[model samples]
Every structure is written in structure tokens, then in C-alpha cells.
Target: MATPLENGFSAPALRLHALDSEDLALLSAHVQDALVRVGDIAYLPAKRRFALVGSRFDWTAEMEGRLERCRAGLHFESVQRVRCARVSRDEPDAILELLAVTFEAGPEPPGGVIRLTFAGGAAICLDVECVEAQLCDIGPRWKTAARPTHELSSSESGAP
Candidate 1:
């Protein structure tokens, strides 16, 4: 059954625990390919690796996204204070609530789910219903930039 969304859209099906370490590692290297800064806009150079910067679960997912964006040269605005988690099976109801609140809809719900494909082509679809509620559930954290594009200084990050 397709769930309701903010723009009347529906996300594709999601597969849980499909991403492996290699995939996550690649993704991590990509996201961190440029600069190691969170809560700010950064650019990822061509064919760079994503950065791995969080728990084994959510970080992998984020890294996967970074891989896609960097490899394809896609661009997006910076996310202010990110708190992520992979809730494929452990929290169905919570995910539903997230969809509702993230989209700002009441009992009926609001936004749709999004498909997130991993490095090896494994895809996971998630919804953002209660944006605020969902965000509250997460904690503040930092994600490194793509390795190759990372802006490092001798006195700052100890690299380059």
C-alpha cells in the first residue's frame, strides 16, 4: 500500500540491511571527498570517495547518498545539524510518524517516501512525514567531506 506524502507522492519499496561495509566505506569516502565540515555547503570533486563519519548504520546510508551525488556531479544545499538512522524494520510505526510529522500532516499523514540506492545498487526508500518530530528523534553529529576534495590544513585537520 502506498502511503500519503506532502506533495501527494509515494516512495518506492525499501530493503533493510542490504548495504555492506565495502559499500559504506565507498560512500563515506565520497561524502567526505571535499571538505570535512558539517552544517555548511561544500562541493565534491569528480569521482571522489565519500567520508565515513557516524554509526555503522546511518553513516552508511548517508555515504551512499554522497557517492551518488559526487559521482554524478549532483548538487544540494547544506543540511543544518543532521541526525540520521536506518529504520527499515526496527521502527515501522516510528517511520510512519516521521512521515507524518516531517510533512506536517495530522492523523491522515502528509508526505511520501524516497528511494535511496546504495553503492552496489541496493535501494532503500524512506518517508518524511513529521519533519520536526523526526528531526527531534535524532542527535547532532558531523560528517566528513569527500577524501579527494577535502580542504585540509596543517594546523586544522592535520592533513595535506
Candidate 2:
């Protein structure tokens, strides 16, 4: 339960440690509107860890102005393509909004999978060496080309 900025400037800009399933669940909720490029994912089994970086797009009033410019079909130099899309499981054809990315760790032998759950139930699971992974923030914020449209229904998410 720490903010991405909790550790101060010396931290990895954004990094989480010992994040179990419950931790990931909480993180998914915090990273509500991050952007992810579907094709930019990687999992290296030999390292016993997987790493995925996302642009911080948790939206604020200042970003609203940039979002409007993007909507007007004007490309904002401040907005990088990597910050405008999300990861999708239902459809891998393009970048999609990042709703949540969960890590389910397996027993010894160091194995698990990183599941990137996009808006809706769409998700992409990456088999990794283990649950040792760090999602860091490595890019500037940008206005999304489009906002995702989906609902996280209780019946669908099964969280009461």
C-alpha cells in the first residue's frame, strides 16, 4: 500500500517489491488508467523475474487539456505513442488501455505468470520464472489517442 512516489527520487521511479496476488490486486486498482503497448512485453525465465514498464497516465486536471488536444486530432509532442495505448487480451491487434496487471506466483522451481488484464476481461498472461517482477515508470505522461470503454462489473470481476 505505497504510492509510486513513496520511496522518493532515489527509487526506480516506480517499482514494487514482494508483490503477491493481493498486492497486485491493490496495485491494479491504483493503476486504473495506465497505458501499455501489447507488443512491448517480455518475460525472461532465466532471470526468475519479468519486467514491464508503463507510462504514468493516472489522469489529472492538467492532463485533461492535453487529452482534449489529442481528441481534436492534434498530435501533442508531449504525448508519446507508448503512453496512449493499453494492453488487451481479447484483441491483440492494437494497443489498449491498461486496467490491471496481475502476477500469480507458483511454487518452487521459480515459475509463474504475469497477467495483463486490460479494460474488460481481456488479458494476456506471460509465463515467467516467478512472481519476481517490477513494473516501473520510464516515460513521460501523454494524452491517450482514445479512452477505453468498458465496465468492471461485479458479475464479471466477481468482487463483492
Candidate 1: which stretches are off by over 4 Å? Answer: 1-109, 132-160
- What's the true lDDT of residue 156 in model 2? 43
Q: Give lDDT tens digits, candidate 1, residues 1-160.
A: 3323343443222222213233323433333322111222122333221211111222343534532111112121111222233323333232111110011123534333322222222222333332211011012223334322223233322111
- Cα lDDT of candidate 2 equals 0.43
Q: Residue-wise lDDT of candidate 2 within 15-126, one digit each (tens)?
A: 4443456655655654556554545444444443334444545433224343311110000011111211233334534555567766556574345555666665445555
Each prediction's whole-model lDDT (CA): 0.25, 0.43
Q: Which candidate number maximizes lDDT?
A: 2
Q: What would you estimate as the lDDT of candidate 1?
A: 0.25
C-alpha TM-score for every candidate = 0.20, 0.49
